[model samples]
Target: MSVELNHTIVHCRDNRESAEFLAHILGLSTGDEWGPFIPLVLANGVTLDFATIPAGSITVQHYAFLVSEAEFDTAFSRIEERGITYWADPHRKLPGRINHNDGGRGVYFPDPSGHGMELITRPYGGWPEGSPVVPGS
Candidate 1:
């Protein structure tokens, strides 16, 4: 059997708000509930389970997505259109600049819950020309 990532649980103060925030930024749909979670599943079939929690009880986490050059352009445009700030590095020091690491573009931002959201075109290693690079690969 092959192992694959199915979903991840995200604890938030407001599940709906957090789910909507992530869906809006990542260009996904929200408002869908599964059991006790408001899920925002991406095109890759990985669901971000937004679960509600008590007040002042949420820890920030980091999640990254690998996107294509075209998708990166579109998502980056959406990010700017939504007035969301982005940074080149994960440390968030180089604000408003996209990274050109591995000969592809990448940007890092934060979600409503202060979770680090990242979109990268290339992985740590480089990809050959003509190879399809899906978002959040």
Candidate 2:
């Protein structure tokens, strides 16, 4: 009855690697392999179908995920454990740090395919009253 995002194709150098990487970070499991895709379904019912493509042909994309504070803590620890470089801001001026924007925590990191992955505990517009609106945090 209403428009919804069902699935999206994420082009990566290796579908299985991309899918597994994201699954580990999100604490989720990937769906069974099908054709050229390795599906990673979200709690909201959206499926990210990773497909292997030529590295030169893949255009890195930015994917932002809004997670609970607990989830953020868990995922952020995994990021550090893996020694992944992260930034407090999207511009990446502050490396090895996270942002406290909108009264919540967030970090930006790159996926194996070079896609920009963002994890935030609060939506940008959900800032508390009297808090300054932060752009690109």
Which candidate number would show the highest TM-score if scored against the true structure? 2
Tens digits of per-residue lDDT for model 1, 1-137:
88989999999888898898877766778856988899888788888899988858888888989878888888888888888888877776678787677777788888877889998888857434443323422
What C-alpha lDDT, on a 0 to 100 scale, does residue 87 get in candidate 1? 83
Q: For each candidate, what is the lDDT?
A: 0.79, 0.87
What is the per-residue lDDT of model 2 for residues 1-137, given as tens digits with 9 covering 90 to 100? Answer: 99999999999999999999989998999999999999999989999999999999999899999999999989988888898888877777778778787678889999999999999998986534443334332
Clashes by residue pair, model 1: 66-136
Q: Which stretches in model 1 have alpha-carbon errors above 4 Å? A: 126-137
Can you give the lDDT of residue 20 in candidate 1? 88
- Supply the global lDDT for candidate 2: 0.87
TM-score of each: 0.84, 0.90
Q: Model 1: how far is 132 from its true place, Å?
A: 23
